[model samples]
Target: MEHDGQLELYTAVADQLKEAHARVRASQVPEGVRMALTRKLLVITAAAKHDLADAARRLESFMKDLDEGRIPEEDH
Candidate 1:
């Protein structure tokens, strides 16, 4: 896939995460548990963001390698 396609996919993922976070924040739960859950969600969201960045970097690198004729041999 091309860079634009990758970017559109990433943007959709980001939008979904934003919507999830908003829903969690808007929940009407007990105070202590709500705060704890919110914090945990924040950490999870951050980790997901990091993972997404890493995936994008890897995809770009792979594309570059392919463009440069660095394809590996297929196993029969």
Candidate 2:
């Protein structure tokens, strides 16, 4: 349900997409708006995943640097 301390945004968005797709498939009339919205949602989720990956890499690098005493502490 949560990741990276406490975050379920990505998971919730994915779950919402699945539910929306089911509705769109069952509707007889053209749900152009729904389809478009779903597409946007897909793009956003994909972007989020990509961004998260980048963040993880940065976090790992930061942690490693800190462990090696190479990371400079913020000026207080």
Candidate 3:
């Protein structure tokens, strides 16, 4: 059913979010950069409440950036 599919998607996103958090924490980036990344993740978490699919897409893009070494510069 559609409900079941949504539940699965939610579960998968939740798991991915956890892994993403761990990755950010384990990353060697500077503290400011890590904090910014954390803020982005938090925004994605909040967005999931209203638009889960969009949140998942955002999270995926975020993870891809991390994996590809595309870290943002730390703000002064």
**TM-scores of the models, in the order given:** 0.50, 0.37, 0.96
Worst 10 residues of 1 by lDDT: 67-76
Which residue pairs collide in model 3, if any? none
* Model 2: lDDT of residue 12: 49
Model 1: per-residue Cα lDDT over 1-76, one tens digit each: 6888768868865665565457546755556645654554555456556676654454444445434655443322
TM-score-better candidate, 2 vs 3 = 3
Which regions of candidate 3 are displaced past 4 Å?
none
Q: Highest lDDT: which candidate?
A: 3
Against the hidden true structure, what lDDT does model 3 obtain?
0.94
**Model 2: how far residue 63 lies from native, Å:** 40
Assess each prediction's global lDDT (C-alpha) against the native: 0.56, 0.48, 0.94
Cα-lDDT of candidate 2: 0.48
Alpha-carbon shift of residue 7 in model 1 (angstroms): 1.5
- Higher-TM-score candidate among 1 and 2? 1
